[model samples]
Target: MEKANSSVPKPRKTSVLSNYEISVSIAFKRDCEVFLVEFAKQKTLSYAKFANIWQLKNMSYIFADQTYVSLLKTLCEECFAILTQCIIHQKNVYMKIGALYLLYGLYYKQPIEGMVKIRVSYDEYTIIKDLMDEMAKEKYMEPLFIFAKLKADVAFNYVGCSMPRSIRFIKNTKKAFTAHTLNANFGENPLSKFEGILQDESVVKLQDTCKRYEMALKKNSSIYPNIDQFKSTIMDDLNAAHKKLFSEDHSTPSEQIETDLKILNSRQEIKLRALKSENATYRGAKQVLTAIDLE
Candidate 1:
C-alpha cells in the first residue's frame, strides 16, 4: 500500500496510516474478500479506510482548483443509492454514529465538489438536527468535516440568497423605485420582508405565476419540473403549514437570488464553521490536561 503524504505535518491524533486503511486502498484495486476478512478480525480496516477516505490534506488540492462542476458530476448515483438505503435501515443513534464516520471517509477520500447531495439531504431538517446532536456529544473529529460543509451550504446557499432581502442591488432598487411602505423594510422573517410586498396572498399568487414562467423558461419557456424529474414518494409527509406559508411568501426577486448565488458560487475561501459543543472549552481542556500537565 502507498502511504499517504501531504505538505503539512499530520496532527498527533491522526498521524499514522492504519493497516485496514491500507488494505482497503489495496482492496480499492485488488481483493475485497481478503480485506473484509481482515476488517472483521481487526475492526481497524473500517476505521483506517474511513479516515483515509476523508483525509483533509488530500482534499486541499480540489479546494485549490476551481473544478466545482467536475466535482458535482463525480458523485456516483449507484453508490449513493446504496448509502441512503443503509441510512434508512438503521436506528437514529446507530445511523448518526456510523453514518458520520462512513460519510467522513467517503468525503475525504473522494473530495468531490458539489457532491453533498449523496450523503445527506439539506432540505431534511431532522437529518441535520440528529447528526448535529450526535456531534455535540463527544470529541468527534471527523463529523466536523460534514458540519463545515453543511454550514457553508446553509450560510452561502440557504440563508444567504435563499432569503432574498439580503442582496444589495434589490435594496438599492427598493429605495429608488418602490414607495410601498413595506418595500424597503425587511421584516424579522428575512424571506418575507423584501421591498414593497408583505401580503401573503399576493406573494403566493406571484410565486405561482413565476413558477409557471420559470417552467416555461426552462423548456425554452415550454417545459417544467415534472413527475419524471422527481422520485415517486409520499407528498403527504410534507407539512401543509410549510406549503401554505411558502405559497403566501413572494419569492425574493429572481435577480437577487441569482446575485447572492453568484457571490456564494464565486467564493474561493474555504468554509470553516464549527459544530456546537456539549462540553465547554474549559471542560474540554481540563479533560485533555489537568493543572499539572500545562507546566
Candidate 2:
C-alpha cells in the first residue's frame, strides 16, 4: 500500500496535560471550586474578578475558611505537579506561577492550607520564623512580590528536603512560579478596605489563607526537582479526600413528615379561604353597581 500522504497533519497533539497535565487541571479545578463556594456565599466575585484578584498587588481583602482550606490542599498538590511538569516539558515558568496565583485567591480564604500546620524540626521552625519576620519587615518581600526565578528558588528550598523522599522529584521543578507571578498583569481588580469590614467574615478567612500559603512557600528551602510520578500518587490522595468529604450519611428527621403534611394542608386551606374572600369582594362590588343602575 502507498504511504497515503504521511504528512496529513499527523493528529496535532490535542491532549497536552498528560498524567501531569491532568493533575494540574484537577488542581486548577479545586481552586475554582473554592472560589465558586466563597463567591457564591459572598455574592461578590465573578470569574473576571477572580482573574483580577490573581493579578493584584495589594491582596489583603481576599479570604476563605476551613472548607476552602481543604480545597486548597488539593490545589497545592496540583500546583506542585504543574511546576514539575513544566520543567520536564521545558515549558514556561509563567504558566506555573499563573497556577499558583489562582491558588492564592482560594488559599486567601483559608490560610491554614499553606500554613505549616504540622510540627517541624527546630531548623524548619527557624526558617519559617525568619521568613515571616522578613514579611513583617517588608511586605513587598512577600513571595507573591518576588520574580519567578527567586520564587522557584524559594519553592525548592521550602518543600525539597522537608517533604518525603518519595516525592523528592519535586526539587527539579523550576521557574514557572516566578514567571507568572512577575510578568502577567492579568489586570487589577480593586477591593476596598472599608469594604473589607463590611464584607462577610468568610472573605477575611480566605485572604488570611493566601497569606499563610505565601508564608509556607517562602519558609521552604529545599532545592528539589519535580517528579512526574508524584502526580498520580497525589491524584489518588485527592480522590480519597473528595470521597471522604462528600459522603453524606445522616438520616432524615422524623418531625419533617408531620411538618410537611401540615404545611401542605394549611396552604390548601389558605388558597380556598383566599378564593372565598375574593368571591365576597366581587359580590359586594356587583351589588354596589346594581344599586347605582337602579338609582
Candidate 3:
C-alpha cells in the first residue's frame, strides 16, 4: 500500500480519457484473471498473450491515469494471492508445479513497457521460506530448487520498501568495522605473540639473517633461511611504520563480504525533488501524463 503513491496528478473524472480507462481496466482485469487460470493448467504462457492482457504496449498512449494505477496494483496482488494459495493449499504436486511456473513467468516475463511487474509482500515470502525449510527437513530438495529463481530474486524487489527482505548476508562474521575508524579483522592472529629470542648472535650476523629471511619469505632463498637464531632481529621494526601511521588501537587483517551486502540492502532514499521533475529526468521510467498540468 505504501508503494501505491502516485506522482502523476489525478485526472478529471468527467474527462473523456478518464471515462475510457474505466471500461479498459474492467476488461483488462477480467482477461488477466482468466490468463492465470489458463496458464496454471497449461504450464506455459507467451509474452504476446500476456502483453495483450496487460493492455499497454511500449509506446501506447496509456499512462498512469487514476483507474490505470488501481489496476496496476490489483493485477500484481491478485496473481500473487492466487499463486500463494495454489502452492500452499493445493495437495497435487503437479498443480503446484503448474502454479510455480505461472509465478515464474509473471516475475521474469518482459511485460509491455514493463507493466506486468510482480512484487511479493514480506509476509507472503515467509510462507515459501517455511515451506522450503519443511521440505528440506523431510529430505525433499528438488521441489525447493524449482522455486529458487523466484525465492532468490524476490529479496531484491522487497528491499528499500516497507517489506523486510527474507534473505540477507549470504556470509557474515560480524567484525563491526566502518570507514570512520576502519576497525577490522577477527579471530586469533597467526603472529600475535612476539617473544624475542635472547640469542647471543652479533648485530652483523642478525642483519645478514634478516636479508636471508626476506628472501626465504618470497621463496627466493638460495639455501634454507636458518634464521631462527635472529628471530628478534628479523622483527626489529615490524610495527614501527604501522604504529606511526595508525594508533595502538588496531586489529588483524580480516576479509569483508558484509560491506557489499550493506550497500545492496541499504534503505531507499526519499526523492521529493524527483517527484516534480521531467519524465525522463526522474524515476518516471513508466510515467504517463493524464492532463495538460505539469509536475
Q: CA lDDT, every prediction?
A: 0.39, 0.40, 0.44
Q: What's the alpha carbon RMSD for model 2? A: 27.8
Rank list by TM-score: 3, 1, 2
TM-score of 3: 0.28
Q: Which scores greater on lDDT, model 1 or model 3?
A: 3
What is the lDDT, from 0 to 100, of the residue 117 in candidate 2?
Answer: 23
Model 2 TM-score (2 dp): 0.23
TM-score winner between candidates 2 and 3: 3
Predicted candidate 2 versus true structure: per-residue lDDT over 72-104, tens digit per residue: 454345544443332223223233333334444
Per-residue CA lDDT of model 3 for 110-132, tens digit only, reads 23344444445466457666767
| Candidate 2: segments with Cα more than 4 A from true spot | 1-75, 80-97, 103-109, 113-144, 148-163, 166-295
Worst 10 residues of 2 by lDDT: 183-192
Clash number for every model? Answer: 11, 39, 0
Better of 2 and 3 by lDDT: 3
TM-score of each: 0.26, 0.23, 0.28
10-60 per-residue lDDT for model 1 (tens digits): 765521223322332332312212212222332332344433323322422
Provide C-alpha RMSD values for all models, in order: 28.0, 27.8, 26.6
